[model samples]
Target chain A: MAKTLTIAPVSRLEGHAKVTINLDDAGNVADTFVNIVELRGFEKFCQGRPVEEMPRIVTSICGVCPWSHHLASAKAADGVFGVTPTPTGRKLRELCNSVAYTEEHILHFFFLAGADFVLGPGADYKTRNVIGVAAAVPEIGKKVVHNRHLGARILNIVSGKSIHPVTAVPGGFSKPLTDHERDMALKMASEILEFAKFSIAWAKESVFPKYLDAVKTVGVIKTGYMGTVRPDGTMDLYDGKIRLMKPDGSFVDFDDTKYADYISEKVLPWSYLKFPYAKSWNEGFDMDLDHPKGVYRTNTLARLNVCDKLSTPMAQKEFEAFRQAFGRPCHLTLLYHWARLVELLYNAEYAVQLLKDPEITGRETRVAVKPRAGRGVGHVEAPRGTLIHDYETDDKGLVTNANLIVGTTHNNAPINMAVKQAAKLLIKGGKYDEALLNTVEMAIRAYDPCFSCATHNLDGRLAVRIDIHRPDGAVETMAN
Target chain B: MTERSPIGLAVTSVHRDPAEERPEPEDFLDKEVLVIGCGNVMIGDDGLGPAFIKHLEARGGAPAHVGLLDAGTGVRTVLFGMVLAEKRPKRIVIVDAVDMGRAPGEVFEIDLAEVPPLKADDFSMHQLPTSNLLRELRDQCGVEVRVVAVQVAWLPDELRGGLSDSVAASLERARELVERLY
Candidate 1:
């Protein structure tokens, strides 16, 4: 008989994940999977819709990181519409991207991951949360609140709302900015800049080295890194080419527009998350390819590796420092948080520049868009990794086909591999405890995935719900 | 004024990322005051109290208390942050947009402890929900946090300076309370 410990979906953190450790005949730890059991089928439900609705429709993915999906989805739709965003549209889009980064990254580090660091992994699940952080590290907790609070406020001003902004339309914003909003954005950007810088220095001084030392040796090392880069060879979020750094720390043909030829997603039997492989290696590949196989990593660390240089000098320095430590293409997964803070710094600096820019407050927000028929691929560097959205539409502008390479899907392969490694590291049949749970959570946290969206649809209308089906076309379960 | 008592109004969006990444202070060593405020500025008059709180935090007049927190319309997570801190603050004041149905611009303080109970599905950040916080305070640190709220006039999605003329006029008064409270 196998004893299974169940952990339910908790607020804060990325998404709902369940861990069930399986025991062998002798009741030892034979195998375990930190299962993302809840089937969030945004793809299946999104079929046969207008390509224009893709951005707002997919905003139903997750409450915390909706803006990420919105941007990715919008770009995909924009691509289908066959329009290159004007410079103003691009700037506003980046501005919105900055807000999402500030809010999502800060929320994760402070409210979600803060528990493990401040309260220790041994803290009770109910008490070991953001509330616990406030009681335990009140001084720092306040700072965390101030930082995220300001970010949220800034998003509301620029995009009209923080989470599921309706401003970033197909070609551009719904309403152009007023002078007051722009001025307010600049002032708040200053505080947010301070907030981000404080975040980076604090992590370096207190958190990074400690976490790096502890979990650096936990997972099986894999070095293939990937992310998005601007055509001009700078870090980018809104529009850029996807770059994958090979294990040798060498660049593999920096690409823009030609994305479909390079990336492919596969599924492993162990975990529900999809495994993405480079198009070259995906052929003739089955689930388990034996030992010493190439492992592709998405999320912050991979993005850090692919960029020519960070958009901001401070982040570039940190990137250099990170590279200097373990050599280029760092393989350790636990260092994802460190990469995120570095990006946060760059984002803040960029936000300062965007906020202070006079162009952002312009009255011209829309780029005249026409519904000409063409297949377009919109790729943006989601906080997680290279998020690619491809749409094929008919002459009427309705989406005939759609494909999404979500950020979490890229992390699936590494997560499955890391789980086995982490399970083996801990002696099986040892009392089920916080240390073991932390080991599992930390492994997936390395991926830093944004799973799905949850919205109430406001206006007294019910938002979309998640539906998971089986191979036989029957509903496995419904999360309403 | 239709001010809510920082108890029930909540904000939700599926497009946002869940709290995968939390924020640490840019300068943890320099942080001092934490103010927890909530309300949607775009939603008519709901922006009242939280808007005032934002004004003060932006201007940097918060006392040398500890930190100013904008819990937003998501008090559940805000409470989570408050309870997680290892170094408990000397004081905490929760500001929000409430609907007391009073004349607009009439500022008043209400106790979160005295507020009505929220249901299981209720996810509002208006008033600091106490059930979870109370347990953590007593069991973990042996101290219950404090909360403050102001009356709300309207909660339409478009509250610029003209929409809430009362809140816009009484904004300074609300700032004064925060200043005094700190």
Candidate 2:
């Protein structure tokens, strides 16, 4: 008789999720599903609200990546009003984006996924966490905390608030940077750049080599990729055309406003989150490991794969090394951590560049706008992945409709496929241990997914419980 | 004004010397008491925490030594920063809505020990690690921590603003409790 095994609320992720694996009568792995609870009320809540309020209101959607939502919403509002931000305004917004990326990348790489690499995946559960990482590598831990704090401080100076920022507006930035403030931000950003340099070097030296075997094998999938890039094919997190790349390295670029034409969302009965696939490929949605159709991934690895080159010199060098080792369109899921470090260095470098720009302190940051009936689509490369916000407004400036496709949602299908691949590869004849299970989780963690952003609905039910269904019609439950 | 203490807790103001240069992150912890309202304002009764903060503001806000913040869903960023900071507030009071099988609109205090250990290794703020981080702040960091909870009547399955009447009514009561923490 077949049996089922479940791992609920996969630990160390941003939000709640579970993995259910089925075994055949021979006790061999048959199938796997990653169930993520998604909130469905945000778009509905945006309806009837003034378009200007979206940037502020949308921040509450996910505390983990509010800056992403905030900036995307502001850009969407700018689209609704059909106004381009002043030069300085645009630079400031980009500065914030880079800073936010540095902060999130550090947190995810060092604290969240770091536990797995810093402490071996097989380490005892009790001693495998941020605290454990801190206890073991005291110096690195201190640097992590200090640098993370510095990112927040820079944001606080650039914008009035750091967490749920209100500084980015439809026309442009709400606050102007004083010379002194710019100096402070520049100094801190320079420091972050140094840390970014140190981070990738340390990982290359200490973390990646030790985990090379896992990196080459775990969660490996052959899917298309998507990300934002400049007209010249350079990675641009703040603004750019969307690039969709095939597994074979072929690609196409399109304006974000035309995203609906290229991407389509599929609803799955078991999971609340929607699976987004490359509709333009016309391959029809599928997640078969041997041949995935229209199933592409976003976030770090995908972004790195899609971008032709990195804008910053140091990051460009790292990108070249990564390509030389893994080749273009790298399918190694674990490389997401490596790709994330590259982006971290790029963003840190980008922040310093923006701050040093004389125009970053220009007085005219925003332009006046009148509420009008219009539709706007805005996209950004959030640390998790590509984030798109679509909004339509009436003449009265009230929101008539709203749609959002967060970065994590773009990887929904891929996440499921990766989880399935990992489960099938690691669990042989139903033999699995905590360490093995965690290694499987590392596959998912590599994406650094933020379920909090992917999920919009909340029912107040919180816990990680696993259920084992035996062939005898009996069930066993386990929780963490 | 008379100093107030809540059950075995002593409240005292620690003002920074005027001559000292105050950095930005430390400015947050400069107050003797920090009251943070944590919840999603767009999610039904979960909006109660921020609503309570608004209520306190409407009532002329807290004293100079107290800092009131509407953290919304971003409380983790603030709390996480605090846990790792060299300097921190003497006491932190978190106000949010909870469902503990109690009467709607009911206001109660949850001991630090009552915060469940939802995920032991989960450190992400988007998960249940907020409680874990809170515990860490209290146990390892030596910060006085307290929780003021309001039993939620209903949490909508869809995104809808405004709290249910019961939760909306409890805001004033919750405000009073938070004031007592200072």
Candidate 3:
């Protein structure tokens, strides 16, 4: 008789999720599902609100990636009003995006997933967390805290608020970067750049080599990729054309305004999140490990794979090394961690470069705009993945319709596929331990997914519980 | 500057340079008391936290030694900083609306040790591990942590703004209770 094993509320990686694996009579894995709660009513809530309010209103969607939403919504509002931001305004927005990416990437790499690498996956559960990482590597721990704090400080200076920022507006930045503020932010960005450099180096020298075996096998999948890049095919997180690469390394770039033509969302009955696939490929949606159709991934690995080169010098060098070793379109899911470090270096370098530009401190950051009936689509490379915000407004400047495809939503199909792959690979004949189960979670962590943003709701309760369903229908539940 | 205590506890030294530790422009530790409201304004009664902060500001805010912050859904980041900071406020008071099977609009105080496990998988800080972070601050860092909770009248399943009538009315009472903490 077949039995079902459930890992509810998979620890870490943001938001709630559960893995349900079915075992055949032989105790071999048969099927798997990753169920995530759905967030409803955000679009309905945005209806009737002023288009100008979206940048601020959308920040409340998820505390984790508010900056992403804030900027995306602001860009959408700019589209609705049909006004481009001043050059300085655009630079300031990009600067914030870079800084925010640095902070988020650091947090995800060091604190969230760091526990796994810093303290071996088999380490005791109680000691396998941020605190554990701090305890073990006290010096690195201090640096992590200090740098993350620096990120907040820089944002606070550049914008009035760091968490729920209101600086980016429909026309441009609400606040101008003064010379003094710019100096302060520049100093901090330099510090973050140093840390980013140290981070990638440390990982390359110490962390990655130790996990070489795991990196090559765990959660490995052959899927297409998605990310944002400049006209020259250089990675650009703030603004660029969207590129969708096929599994075979071939790709096409499209305008953000035309995303609907290339991509479409599929509703799955088991999960609240929607699976987004390449509609333009016309391959249809399938998560089969051997041959997936229209299934592509976003976030770090995708961004690295989709971009032809990194805009910054140091990052470009690292990018070349990565591609030389892995080749175009690396399919190893765990490479997301390595790719994240590369992007971190690029963002840090980009932030410093932006600050050095004299125009970044200019006075004219925003332009005047009149409300008009229009539709706008804005896209950004959020740390999690490619984030797209679509909005429609009336002549009165009120939002009539709103649609958001967060970075995590795009990876929904990929995450499920990865989880299934890991389960099938590891749990043969139903043999699994806590460490093995956590390895399954490592697959999800590679995506650095934010279910909170994907679902757009918060209930403030998360606990990990696993239920084992026997052939007789009896259930045994376990929690951490 | 550092020492190991428990697995999940924060270890920070008390005496440190304010300039070296504070995150600039906002010296939360300079205040004797820190009061933060945590919730999402777009989520019905969940908006109580920000709503209460606005109410407190309308009433001229807290005293000079008290710091009032509307953390929204980003309370975890703030609390995490405090835990790792070399210097921290003597006391922290978190105000939010929760459903604990009590009467709507009921104002109550919860001891830090009693915070239930209600959050998980929040990348930055949503709610569950916030309690854990608070506990670490109190037990590991020696900061007094208190929770002021309001029983939400109704929490919508979907996004909706504004507090319910009862929750709105209780803000003043919650404000009074929080001010007394300072």
lDDT of 3 by residue, A1-480 (tens): 777777766776576677888787678787777877435448778888778878998888777888999999999988998888889889989999999999899988988899899998999887787777889898998898888888888888888788899988887887777777777889999999999999999999989999999998999999999999999998899898999999999999999999999999987555567799999999899888788888999999999999999879999999999999999899999999999999999999999999999998777778777767899888898999999999998777778898989999899999989998998899988688989888998999999998876864334322233445577766665444
On DockQ, the stronger of 1 and 2 is 2
lDDT of 3 by residue, B1-182 (tens): 01212221111112322233223476566788998898888778888888988899998988888998888988767877777777789998989888788889999998755555562222125323333677678888899988899988887776778899999999989988887888
Clashes (backbone N, CA, C under 3 Å), per candidate, total 91, 3, 8
TM-scores of chain A, one for each prediction: 0.87, 0.95, 0.95
Q: Please, what are the lDDT tens digits per residue for candidate 2 over residues B58-136?
A: 9998898999888888786787777767778999998888877899999999886664443122223633333377777
Candidate achieving the largest TM-score: 3
By summed lDDT, which 10 consecutive residues of candidate 1 chain B come out lowest?
A: B6-15
**lDDT at B60 for candidate 1?**
73
Clashing pairs in 2: A39-A456, A39-A457, A41-B159
* Segments of candidate 2 deviating more than 4 angstroms: A38-40, A456-480, B1-26, B116-131
Query: On a 0 to 1 TM-score scale, where does candidate 2 land against the true structure?
Result: 0.91
Q: If you assessed candidate 1 against the hidden native complex, which CAPRI class would it receive?
A: incorrect
Model 3 DockQ, alpha carbons vs. true complex: 0.16
Off by over 4 Å in 3: A38-40, A456-480, B1-24, B119-131
